[model samples]
Target: MSQAADLPAEAPSARVLVDFDRVDLAYDDTGGNAIEDVSLTIREGEFVAVVGPSGCGKSTFMKLVSGLRPPSEGTVIVDGREVSGPIKIVGMAFQAPTLLPWRTAMDNLMLPLEIVEPYRSNLKQNRAEYEARARGLLKTVGLEGNEDKFPWQLSGGMQQRASICRALIHEPKLLLLDEPFGALDAFTREELWCVLRDLWMEKRFTVILVTHDLREATFLADTVYVMSRRPGRILVRKSIELPRPRDLEITYEERFTDIVLELREHIGRIRKA
Candidate 1:
């Protein structure tokens, strides 16, 4: 993984933002639980990465955070409020771009505004303003001038950028990214990392990224949590002490590799356990 230089100094205060207390989740009508005894707190505007082996409920955790799923036990609170159904404050992008084939890049970016509130009710009255917002977000993600193209016409990376734009169009306070770059090649994935990093730096949204890529987590997160296999208990919590405003070149440095290796060891231990 290549990283940028000019590491950022750590922020002074680490106040809590999202809190998970002894949380346990099991799908309705399913006999088994997906996550158990999960407890962690993410600081406001913090970048937290959750990494684990496959089927360790990393995606399930995303659902919980976004209030898409209710816990069978324990509590999930964001900003001191308990999370109920479908939090309006969350923006999500997933493994696949999942952009509608029928919509052009700009239209796809405007999808959320068509459904989510404040904008939903005013979409007709505020179409011009909304379109302008989507256009700005597209440019930020390097999707400039591709707005008129349909999803099929854009490359996978371009489509993913549009998807992220759709997610952020409403400007939610929390961003839930579930392996959004998993389908991309290494080069494209790194490129998107910088895209996401710059967006996060500028927006300061609380982000909880669920991924299996240790290097990706190291490069983009303020803190990384490793989960054990199966029940998906959080087994390790490692603070990435590296300086921020990180670029792609920093990933090649000794410090970056050290953190990745340390996380690799923790995940290896979980696999063996």
Candidate 2:
């Protein structure tokens, strides 16, 4: 794996934004935990990826971080506060675009502002300003001309782009992505990876991406964490020391391949356990 010394010397010192302290989650009284003994800290503006075999509670980690599910044991802290319910500082994009068919791409992007606080209250009063921001986000993700198009009118890649824009339109401090590119073809998925990479480079938002693709995790995250099966626990925390502003070409490099294979070995062991 690449070493931290490879990172730029000018990297900013970041405060811890999300902390899971010996967290465990049990969905039912059966007493079987979905995730157990998970402890990690994600610094503000850090991009972290969680990967494991199917049913390893990767998505459960996202739920805990976003406050959708409270842990049965331990605590989850976000932005200096313990998370008790759905948090306001997080934005999420999932495998499915989940865009409303009736709404144009621009309207879909504006949904967060229409529902989330502060913006929701002032939406009518500042509709023009909000729309301009939405348009800019769409343009940033290569959806400039497609803003007027409905979800059905856009291609799969385009719709995913719109989904990401919607997640960012409100500019949440933490962004959660759950296999956001899993549904796309290989080429399209790689393309969206670059789109997401550029967006993260520009905004530097804290991101927790739950993915099964080791290569995807290696390419996008500052750190990649591997989890155990069932009662998921952090097995490894691999810091990616590849210098920043990385392009897709770096994915083919020897170090990148080594990192991916190392993550793969962890997953293989967990699956065979």
Candidate 3:
């Protein structure tokens, strides 16, 4: 199988933001590894994607970065610090959106500010300021007028946009998206690709997205890491050399199709293995 390590130094020489050194994870003491020999570097402000088939430990990789699970072997470090527990500097959005049904879009975005701290501790004292930030974020994601609407009131696309806003409200250095667009319809999902692309262009926060969609990975990530089937590890790290800010139009180009096909070929091998 192809390997990312064989590729040129795709990551920048600036201070490494995330460093995984031959990492491995196992849930049960006697069970096999979920992921093994996974070492990679994610630089500051880079957008990276991790892709693999179902049950291939892609989600487990996210948990390891978030400090939700400890690696059974090797080091998992972020921003120069080994992730020992839940790191406050990381923000996450998932496939479900998981917005509180009772809250409005604006409230949902501000939820992070109320939960993650110094903002959390001072939320009450700075409610107006936080509300303004939420409103601005909503506007940025094209949910300006929908701020007062409940999650049920928004379409799948809008809700996902709000979820991303919530993740960014805390201004976390790293944003972890675990299949954030997986549940949307194809059209809506593509629309969100633009939404996310715009947001990332504006914010430039480091991102590590976990998804099964090769198209999504190619369009969004600066570097795409394909994982092997369980006992997963980084199989390929294809740097997306596409120019940005990339638009939906770029997706139709021959170059785009070639990259997707190349990645699909790798996945085909992983599945067969």
Question: Candidate 2, overall lDDT?
Answer: 0.89
Q: Show where candidate 3 strays beyond 4 Å.
A: 1-13
Would you estimate the TM-scores of all the predictions?
0.94, 0.96, 0.94
Top-TM-score structure, candidate number: 2
TM for candidate 2 is 0.96
Residues 1-273, model 1: lDDT tens digits: 212231223544466678999999976767778899999888778888999999999999998989988898999998779998888888899989999999899888888888889889999998998899888899999988998999999999988888888888999988999999999999999999999999988988888999989999999998888888867788887888888889888999999999999899888877787
Q: Estimate the Cα RMSD of every predicted model relative to the unseen true structure.
A: 3.9, 2.0, 2.2
lDDT of 1: 0.87
The residue pairs found clashing in candidate 2 are none
What lDDT tens digits, residue by residue, belong to model 3 across residues 1-273?
Answer: 344452323335466789999999987975999999999988888889999889999999999999999899999999889999998898999999899998888888887787788998999999998888888889988897898999999988898999999999989999999999999999999988888888888888899999999999999988899999988988888888888778888889999989999999999988887
Badly placed stretches (over 4 Å) of model 1 are 1-15, 28-30
